[model samples]
Target: MIAAGEVIERPASVVKELVENALDAGATEISVEIRGGGVEQIRVADNGYGIPHDEVELAFQRFATSKLSDASDLDAIPTLGFRGEALPSIASVARLSVVTRHADDDSGTRLEITEGRIVDRQRQGASPGTAMTVRQLFRNVPARRKFLRTTATETSHIQNMVTRYALAYPEVRFALDTGNSSLLTPGSGSLREAIAAIHGLNVAENMLDISVVDERSGQSTVGGVISQPALSRANRGYMSFFVNRRWVQSRMLGYALEQAYHGFLKERRYPLAVVNITIDYDQVDVNVHPSKTEVRFRSGDRVFSAIQQAVRQTLTAHSPVPEIRRAGATHPAYSPASRQPSRYFWPIEPFQPSPAPNAERTGELIPNEQDAASPTSNGDGGFTHKETLPVLRVLGQVQSTYIAAEGPDGMYLIDQHAAHERVLFEQIKADAATSAPQSQSLLEPLTIELNPRQQELAHAHQHLFSSLGLLIEPFGGDVYILRGVPSILVEVDPVRAFIDMLDEMAQGGDVESWSDRAAYSLACHAAIRAGKVLTHGEMTALTRQLEQCQQPHTCPHGRPTIIHLSGSLLEREFGRR
Candidate 1:
């Protein structure tokens, strides 16, 4: 019973061990069903090589496995279940029953275990597969049963485990039915199809096809659908990776993805990807983790560099910035006079001398009339005699999304929206941290009705809205009334923004801190969209503002807001002098 706790902590652990056993048995299709947090009942059915009638009773014995014959097999362990402790451990803590029929035999076998002891065995009529049922889990161990979390939390963990396997084996059909009637059915074949089925077809449609082969390794292959930079999510949970058809987490793989998207995404934002890597079996250790969710490579550094190079080269070749244009169907050329001053001009405006002290200055509100009357500099060296920073020259907009500019050192490509969002995010975060956000009253209050789930989320995060300068009050039922909004986002629709924020929060899975994410979401929405046309001054000012940022190269979402193409890279691409 003590050993059972180590192998199966909760319902999710039981599912993971059972699925691994099925995979080892060569099952092409697997189904899992759980009721009451897998305490009342848990069933795993798999179409695989079944056990013989005689071996049925022995299957639950500790350290007994058909995978390995001798001690030398330990050095070359390939199957998922070699230790053979999972079955024994699980059987020890629950009422366990296994019914199986081998293809070589006509009849099937049924075996039952009660508290780790084989209680019954009989030949029976059953399908040519294996079906195991675990009921009253931890019933023999009262201490373990008492530690289980709520049914909903346990079910969520089980669902997450099922999803990991579904992603790992795209060729296999997988289905998961939770107790609450929430079903996840991933029906058979092709990684792309599986991804589309699970993550939505719209996401798959926008994916950038990526492939790379290494001739030296003698195992070159293609897999992974890179998302367009514009189709990013709020969290990294969407990124899925597999190695040799097994879903495993590799830090090296994540680093490769980051490098590939160095110049494309914003800081703190992660792209949606399904990267599959194929390598020689001997080069990887799949037995690193008990759950088999993590793996280690013999030469991980080399693999990391190769994957990064392949993705970077592919993106650079296929995706390029489009040319910028002005509004009203006009082809505006880049010129010095058309450029505008930067957004940071207000902080560095001219300072005026204060007037002589009067009776009003003593414990009274004295207005700075002289400072108000003084003319302020625009930071472009155009209006006043104050020294200004050097301005970057605007070249054009790339793919109508990134702005290309030339500075004293080198040329840069800037993602206008990401840069602007970062600027606004920093400003808003600082303001909210120091003082209450400035609120702009709306002429008419906007009412928003939410679903039960969204309503719960909004109620839970009411304090987040307060910090962002929004006065949202519950108006009975699942409706909320918005009386004011952040002054910086005055142009935005309050009701729509509030709903979007709620949806984004919900989609993020589990947000530990609501205020931080809310601030980021607000800043992101208030920033410019991808298709907006910027004036010459706006472009110049944007460049200046980006340069002033602490980490100007990347946005807050982890995407590179700018990419510098050196003369060497340009010459190589164009074959020019």
Candidate 2:
């Protein structure tokens, strides 16, 4: 029992093993149910080949498995379980029950084991599948049971585990019930459809399809959906990887993904991706960990390099060049006067004299406000502007997707929408820190309907919205009235923004603290999008503003706002002589 306690720490661990067993059995569908965070009870049902009545008793013996015949079979371990410790170990520490039937048998056997002993066995009519139940986990080991976390925490871990398998095997249907009313059902279908069902629909919509095939290795095929740069996150938790239908964690694979995005993403920002790699099974080892979550590849470096190169090539080929927005000369009312380059001639005519001293002072002796506001030219003849606040320079838009610009001392590239989000984030944060935000009253109050869950979150965060200059109140049922909004968002549709914010926040998880990330996401959604044109002066002003920021290189969300390349580096690139 003690040995089992060490191996099967908690209910989530039990779920992991059982689910793996189902996968190894070639199950096309799996369902899991847990009560009290899986501590009180756990049930795993799968439509897979079941054990024979004769073999039912042997299935709970330690070190016994049908996956291998001898030691030689260890060289190629393709299944999720081979040591056969899962069932026996779990049975030793908990009340374990198994109901299974073989295809040839008309009836099945039910076996119950407790405290490392088979308590009972009976023959019963059952379906052609397997259903395992575990109860009172770690009951004998009170010390270990005490270490278990809250029900919510344990349930979250189970949810994450289920999500991984759902991503790895889109062809397999999966269902999970957490004893609470919460349920997750990802029906069998296409990878995209599965992803949409598991994650939210917005994530699926933003995913970019990426595929790479290597001709030399017949072992190479990488395909997945990657999030656009604008939709990046602060962590890599959302990224999922599967190799040959098996989910395994490989640091090398993660590094390869980062390398592939070398010049594309900003620092500290990770791409959301779900990639599946197909390689020769013989070249991989899936028996490295007891949990079977880690993998080892023969010549891992070689595989890593190949995957990185393939993804890099694909991204480079698809990268689009930004378009330059030219200023229109027809809009005389809004356009600045164009000036021609000054020409120098021998014995230039004497400078024209002014009728009054004041006129002469303004023309030559005095500096105008416009000239004073402009940055001073440095010794290298480059303008060196500085500012006191963070600024976002308007760079040209590429494929109407990305924005590029030059900041105070570095080159700035922004997802136009992301940049605007940073600006809006600052504004919201400032308002939040002070008293309630100053709301701009709307002539007509806007009403919005929300789901039960959304309404709950909205009511809970009413104070937070009030601080962000939003005036909202319950209008009975799952509807709310928006009587006002932040002055900056006067032009925006208040009802739509409110609903979208609620959805984004819910998807992002609980956010009760002041430093919650949902605030940043909300700001981003309200910010400007890519492809918006700006004048040269506006771009220059943005550069000066960005220079004033403490961390000028990165925005609030940890995405780099600038990339610096020295003048000397540019010369070297061109082989300047």
Candidate 3:
């Protein structure tokens, strides 16, 4: 009972250990059945090489393992089960029975052990594999049994474990039946297909493939699939990492994944990914933990760099503009991030100041000369994409918000506010790099009051403020004077924009630097608000500038800037195909 505490926590632990043993035995097909959340009955059947009839009795002995012959083999443990503690530990806590026939044996052996004592041993006709049934788990340890959760929760845990293993070994057919519902994977040897089976087809379609190999070392390689920025989840539960085909819990892997999506995911949102890292057995130590889910890498830095780079490169290269779905369309079952945030917050004419007398009638919130100028970039900005969309031809504006246009392959709808924000954010960062942004002194400086925390943030981020053309000075206790603001925000309220910056810096997660946080807020404040009518030339200019942005797909806030409606999709919607 004491040993089982470390290896068998609940029904899920038993399933995990048995599955790992089957995998080590080279099983190509595995099936698992459970009742009462695997506490009443649990069965795992596999077609792997089984134990010989003569040795079947000795298999339950503690520390008896075929994976390693000597202590030196511990340094380079290759198989998933090496200590051989699973059988004995589990037998001591539950009623266990095993029927198996080794490949070289003409007959099979059956053993029924209850509470670590054999009750039945007989010869039987059986296939060349192993079938283990654990019944009345933790029956001998009433304390442990009392601590188990409800049956439904335990079933979810077991199902999750099985799905993860199926992802790691796509070539192995896996099935789990809880006597209520079941899951099956085809073992098609395709990662994408496996993902579709587990997460649904819609999510699988949006996943991007990533593969990176260190040819110089010829020992480490990383490969997997990552969700597009549009297909994220609310938690990191979707991220899975495997080392040498063994599922492991790794904080470094999680951090690397989040870092790769720094500005590409919303607050508290995490990407969905299945990343597998393959390296030499000697390069990683899997015995760090009793469960074997934690690994220590010999070259932790190299592994981190490889994972981060692979995910980053895949995202930058393959991320596409989100598609706009019609009403009543089926939303992806796996994605909560696809639903855009509410847009009603962008105030309309009620919030705009009076237009200048000679301002052009360009459908902008502030019909001023500043809003009419086209956005600019400092470097050659178009990416060398594998499949580039043709230059868009501006059609017209939709609902005074979305810019409807056409391309060679499909139609495009661009969010004017989001597109402009993307453009201005890049420009702000670029200008900050070269020189301070253009600033205009106010006729009379505006004074504002801040709390102690905000005041501290202001003093610490003055350089970032100056870069965005926001010049501030401490006037007195908890008070500051804003001398000038960015040229783009001359017409907007400088005081509100300044306060917004402080709030962002104070509340924003520490992943982004103060400068990025400042630029993000500044761009959002200065960008043209939605619901403004734009002249044809203004619309043309907006889309053209958007195309020059390095990351034209999303705004700084990770909202989609454009939605593409492919020609084939349009045809299907129109009943033409």
Candidate 4:
């Protein structure tokens, strides 16, 4: 039982071990069927070279293996299962049965074990393969059984496990049946086909292929498919990485992939990718953990640089400009193939939603009283220009996204979203400097349902949430109630804003403090979007507030808030000098 704890932490762990064993046996076709969230039953059948009749019972013994022989062999271990503990450890906790026939044998053998004791062994008719069945898993250990999550969550973990292995080995046919759901991947040996099978065809079409080899040694190679900037998910769960054909969770690889899309993707959005790095067996150590999901590389820096460069190269070569997809819209507003470089872009109506009725204006620049009184009587409106900023006259808005103004020397174009983000960030910092940031109460509280993992994270980081003016209280199992939010996020949807904040908090491992992360997330969410239409008064107020910010040149995320076109440059272009 103690040994089983190390190899089988949950139902997914059992599936991983069994499938890995099947792959090691050179299985071309594998099938996995489970019931009762894999706790009541799990059957793994593989068309691989099975054991002989005499070795059927020996395969159940601890530390008995055909993969490795001596201590020296550990240096270059090639097979996935080398310790020989998976079969015995699993049998020790469940009722297990196995039927197999070696390629040389005419018939097969059947063996049964209950709680680590062999009970039955006999001859049976079977094909040249192996089929293992486990029932009532962890029945002997009630303590471990109680630690499992809900059935849905457990099933999700198992499905993710299967999909990951299917990506690593595209030539192997794999099928999974959970009695309620099913997934199958053809052994077509095409990564694109595999991606289309798992994710939809539309997503597969947008993925870009990438391959790069280490020029220094030519021993390490990185290859995979990464999604275009237009296709993105809200989280990083879609990324799957493998080392030497073994699925592993690596921080360095993930970081490299993310860095490649640094400016292309917005904050909190991640691209889907399947990255595989093939290297010499001796260069990596796979014996670091019992699960073998992590490895140590001797030349991690070289591998990291290789992955980053490969992804960047692919994106630069095949990436298309991002397009906006609207409801009931048959096609994107712009087509890449028909696009041509020009001084002006195709005009499209900016997105403008009706303002709420009788809603108190929040996140607007300048006070309500000062908004009515204009400092300068411009033809457009009573413009409120500040002294600290460049003396400018509000000319008009361009593309409903940039605020065009006339400066003393030339013209200035300001990105509305970036400028708002800068203003909100400074305001939040100032509020937090004095007290526990400001919060506004909602007319009606909202209840949010979270998954098991999210619930655990919310509970663990309750203090951080409260510090950011989000008053979240436990409503019931896997549910939280929101009574108020940071003042800046009042106009945003309470549910989405809260959930996005929680997701940001979950990925705060690299952040120095939880407060700073929460603050940044709120500011980004509360800032004005790019396509929003602003009235003359609103634009004037926004520009006024931006002028007073401590750091108005760049947003909190380091994006330029404004662009300056010098008068000399414009004159030279027109030959007016």
- Please give the distance, in angstroms, between residue 293's alpha carbon in candidate 3 and its true position after superposition: 2.9
CA error at residue 527 for candidate 1, angstroms: 19
**lDDT: the better of candidates 1 and 2:** 1
Clashes per candidate, residues 3 or more apart or on different chains:
18, 3, 1, 0
Best-performing candidate as measured by lDDT: 3
Candidate 2 — what's its lDDT?
0.66
lDDT of 3 by residue, 1-577 (tens): 1122368889999999999999998998999999999999999999999998878878899878888888888889889888878898889999999999898999889999999999999999999999999999999999999999999999999998999999999999999899999889998899988888888888888888898978888654999999888788898899999998899999998988898886677768999999999988999998887788999999998898899899888776666666656567775321123322222211211111222322212113322344333232224532221122235667999999999987654688899999888777877787788775777889999999999889988898787788778889999988899998887686689999989988988876553467887888888998888998898867766765665566777888888788778676788889998
Give the clashing pairs for model 2: 391-545, 391-546, 395-404
Provide the lDDT at 255 for model 4. Answer: 88
What C-alpha lDDT values do all the predictions have? 0.68, 0.66, 0.80, 0.76
Across 439-530, the per-residue lDDT of candidate 4 in tens digits comes to 77888999999977678777877876666677889999888899988877877897897787677767766444455556667778999898
Identify the runs in model 2 with alpha carbons over 4 angstroms from their true place: 1-6, 181-186, 216-220, 317-577
**lDDT of candidate 2 over 1-577, digit per residue (tens):** 1122235877888998898888888788899999999999999999888898999999988887998888777777667677878898899889999999887889999999998899899999998889999999998889999999999999988888888888777778888899774545455557777778777676676566777667786544787777655456789888888877677777878878875674456767788888887777678877666666788888787777666766665554332212122245221110011211122211221111111233111111121334323444456642232221113334565555455553232233555454445545655665578765657889998998889988887888888888777788999987888898776565567677777777767764224333344456556556655566654443343333333322333345555454433333445556972
The candidate that achieves the highest TM-score relative to the unseen native structure: 3
Query: Which candidate order results from sorting by lDDT in descending order?
Result: 3, 4, 1, 2
Backbone clashes, candidate 2: 3
lDDT value for model 1: 0.68
User: Which run of 10 residues does model 2 get worst, by summed lDDT?
Assistant: 331-340
Which prediction has more favorable TM-score, 1 or 4?
Answer: 4
RMSD of each: 17.6, 20.2, 7.4, 15.3
In model 3, how large is the Cα lDDT of residue 499?
93
